[model samples]
Target: MTWQLRRAHEADLEAIMHLETITFVHDAWSPTMMARDLGDPACFYLVAFPPDEPSAVEGYAGLLAPRGAVEGDIQTIAVAESARGRGLGRTLMQALINEARKRGARLIFLEVRADNPGAQRLYERLGFIEVGVRRGYYQPDNVDAIVMRLDIPELESMLVETS
Candidate 1:
C-alpha cells in the first residue's frame, strides 16, 4: 500500500479529530486541545493519506520539540482501525522521529499504556528502551504507562538498517 505523509494543516482538523476520537476512544484529546497543539510552534503534526484516497487521512501523529532542545516528546500517534497492520503507525512514528532529529533533539520520550504490547513492540523495534513506568497514568481505565526513551543516534542507525 502506498501512502503520503505531510505536515498537518488547519483544514485537516475534522478528519484528524475523527480518527483520533475513534482510535483513542475514552482517552482521546478534546478538539480544543488538539487545535491548540496543532497551532503550537513547538509541535510538529503530520497526517498520512492513502494512495487511493489522497484526500482522506488514515492516521496522524504529533511531536513536541522546542527549538534547540536536547529532548523531544511523542505527543500522540494513532492510525485508523482500518489502516492498522499496514505500517501506518510505523510511518507516523518515523515521521515524528525525523522531525525531532531535525529540531536538534538528542532523545525522544513517549509513554505507552502497559496493556499496549503491540505499540511497545513497535517502539522497541525503532530502538526505544524502557526507561520507567507511571502507575495509573491513564485515568478512568487505570492503566499504567510504560515510559520509553529513544536516543537519536541509535534511532538513526536503526532507521538506516531498516531502510
Candidate 2:
C-alpha cells in the first residue's frame, strides 16, 4: 500500500484527534488540545494518509525540539485501528525521525506504556533502548511508563538498513 506522509495542517487536527481517540482510548487528546499542539511552533506534526483516500489520516506522529543535551522528544504517535498492522506507524516514525534529523536533532526520546508490547516492539525494532522507567506514570490506571532513547546515528543506520 502506498502511504503519504506530510506536515499536518490546521484542517487535519479534527481527523488527528479522532484517530488519537481510537488509537489511545486510555489517553487521547481532545480537539482543543490537539489544536494547541498544532499551534506550537516548536512541535512538528506529521500525518500519514492513504493514497486513495487523501482526506483520511491513517496515522500521525509528533515531535518537539528540546533544549540543552536533549535533541528532541516524541510527543505522540498513533495509528488508526483500521490502519494498524499495515506498517503505517513505522512509516510515520521514520518520517518523524527524518524530520528531526534535518532539524539538527542528535537524539530522540519517548515514553511508552509498559504494558504496550506492540509499541515496545516497534520502538525496539527501530533501535530505541530502554533508558529508564517512570513508576505510576499514568494516573487513574497507574500504569508505568518505560523511557526509551534512540541515538540519531544508530537510527540513521537502522533507517538505511530498513530502506
Candidate 3:
C-alpha cells in the first residue's frame, strides 16, 4: 500500500483520536488535550494515510520542539495494528526526527512501555538508548515506562518527506 505523510491539521482530530484510543487503549490522551496540542504552534504532528482516502488516518505521531530549542519530546506515536510492520512507524519517526532537527533540537526524548519490546527495538534501531525508567508511568495499568534518549547530530540533510 502506498501511504503518504502530511502535517496533521484540526480536521484530522476525529480520525487521529480514533486511532489514538484504539492503539493506546489503556492510556490514550483525551480528545480535548489532543486538540489543544494539535493547535499548538510548538508541536509538530503528522498523519499517515492511503492517498485514496484522505480521512483515513492509519497512524499518527507528534513532537514538541520549539524553534531554537535545545530539546525535543516525542509526545506520541501510534499506528493502527493493521498498519504495523510495513515501516510506517519508522517513517513517522523519521519525519519527526527531521522536524526536530529543523526546529533546532539537539536531542529528542521518548518513553516506551517496558512491556513493548517491539517499540523498544524500533527506538533502538533509530539510535535511542535507554536512560531511565518511570515506574508505573502508565496509570491504572501500572506499567513501567522505559525512558529513552537520542542525541541528534547537526545534519542539515535530515530532510522532511511526505512520500
Candidate 4:
C-alpha cells in the first residue's frame, strides 16, 4: 500500500496516539508528551495514511532537529501491524533523515530496543552505527536501548559514490 505522508497537525493527535499505544505496547510515550512534541517548533512530526482512508494514521515518525542545529535525534517511529513490511517504515525514516539534513544537521541519532532486530537492521542499512547502550532505558520492561549514530554527510557521500 502506498502511504500518503503529511506534516502532523493537531487533528492527528488521536489517531497517532492510538497507534502509539498499540505499537509501543509496554513503552509508549505519554499522550501529553506526544502532544507537546507535535507542537514544538524544533520538532518535525509526520503522519502516514493510506490513500483510501485519509483519516486513519497507519504510521508516524518524529525528528528533533531544529533549524541550524548541528545534530538531530529521531525521537520515535512506528507502523501499524497490518502496515508492517510495506516500506512505510523505510519511507518514514528516509523522510525524517531528509528533514534533519534540511534543518542543518550533520549527525543523526536514534535508539532502538535491544529486542527489535528488524528496526536495528533498518538503521544499519541506513549507515547508522551502534554507538553505545543505555541500560534499562525502557520503562516497565527493563529493555536496554542500542544507541546508534549516522553521520549524515558521510552516508550521503557514500551513497553518491556507490550510485
Candidate 5:
C-alpha cells in the first residue's frame, strides 16, 4: 500500500472529481469550483497515487494558506473507499499541516460534518479541538458542521515529543 503524494495537476481533475462525487455525494463541489480552487495561487492541492499505477488516484486534499497569513484552512480531504484504513487520510492531513507550518500559519481550521465522528476523531488525534458549530451547514443533507482548530505551535510541540 505504498502511495506517493504530489501536487495535484489539471490532468487529475477527472479522478479527483469522481472521488469527490463518491465521497461527498450531496455536498460535492462542482468540477468548475474545483477547477477554480486548483487555479488559485493561495491554495495548495495534493493527490495521492500508487507508485506502480501513476494514473490511479487514491485520494486528494487541499489547503488554503494565503501568503503571509497566520491562519490556514483545510479546504477538503478525501480518500477513495478502497484506500481507507491504510493511513492515507492521516498522511494527507499531516501533509496539509506541514504545509501550513511551512507557510507560517499559526492556526489551522476546518469544518467537518457533525455526523462524521470518525473524521472528528482523526482531527482530534492530529491536535484539532472543536471551536464552534454551524447548524445545517451542509445543505440538502441538513447536516451540522463542527468547526475545529489547531494551534500550529502546539501541534509542532506534540509532534516533537512523539518523534
Candidate 6:
C-alpha cells in the first residue's frame, strides 16, 4: 500500500509497456511508442514504486496537454495485475492529476473502454463525469469508449478532503 511517485524515465519504458499490454486490449503502445510519448514535451509520465521495491515500478499514469491549454488528457494508467485492488490506480491518478494542476491544467479528460465498469466507477468516484462516447473505438474487440471529463477548478479542495 506504500509507494512513491516520480517522473518516469527511459528506464521505465519496458515496465510501462508491459503494464499497458496487460491492462488494455486495444491501442496498446509498444515500448518504443511509450518511450516516444514519455519523451514528448507535452506529456507527463508518473510512476509508483513500492517502498521496498525501488528498482521496479508497480504502476504508472500518463497525461498529455498542448501548450497553454487549460485541459489535458490522461493517456494511460496501469497497475500490475498482482497489484490491483489496492488503490494503487487511484493513488497514481491523484498524483498525476495534482501534477497536472501544478502545471496549470484546469480540466482532465480520458477515454475508457465502455466495458470497463470497474475503472468507470473509480473515475466517477473521483469526480469525473461521462461526457461522450466514441463508437467502435477499440479495434479487434470493437468496444465503445466512454469519454470522461473532470473539472479541476476546485481540485485543490477535493484533493485536500480526499487526502
Compared with the true structure, what per-residue lDDT tens digits does model 6 show for residues 54-148?
Answer: 66878999999766789999998988888889999999888877777877888999999998899999999888999999999988789999999
Q: How accurate is candidate 5 locally (lDDT)?
A: 0.93
TM-score ranking from best candidate downward: 5, 3, 4, 1, 6, 2
Per-residue lDDT tens digits for candidate 1, residues 1-163, read 7689888988888999999888888798988999999999999999899766757998999999997999999999988888888898898898888889889999999999999999999999988999999999988889999999999874446554443
Model 6 RMSD, rounded to 1 decimal: 2.5
> Candidate 1's error at 137, in angstroms?
0.8
Q: What TM-score would you give candidate 5 relative to the actual structure?
A: 0.94
Error of 4 at 6 (Å): 0.2
lDDT of each: 0.90, 0.85, 0.94, 0.93, 0.93, 0.86
Prediction 6 global C-alpha lDDT: 0.86
- lDDT by residue (56-133, candidate 3, tens digit) is 899999999999999999999999999999999999999999899889998999999999999999999999999999
The residue-by-residue lDDT of candidate 5 on 27-94, one tens digit each, is 99999999988998889999999997878999999999987899999999999999998999999999
Taking all chains together, each candidate's TM-score versus the true structure is 0.92, 0.89, 0.94, 0.94, 0.94, 0.90
Candidate 1: lDDT over CA atoms?
Answer: 0.90
In candidate 5, stretches whose alpha carbon ends up further than 4 angstroms from where it belongs are 154-163
Off by over 4 Å in 1: 154-163
Question: What 10-residue stretch in candidate 6 is worst by lDDT?
Answer: 154-163
- For residues 30-78, write the lDDT of model 2, one tens digit per residue: 7887888888877889988878776888888998874333489999999
In the order shown, the candidates' Cα RMSDs to the true structure are: 2.5, 2.9, 3.6, 2.1, 2.0, 2.5
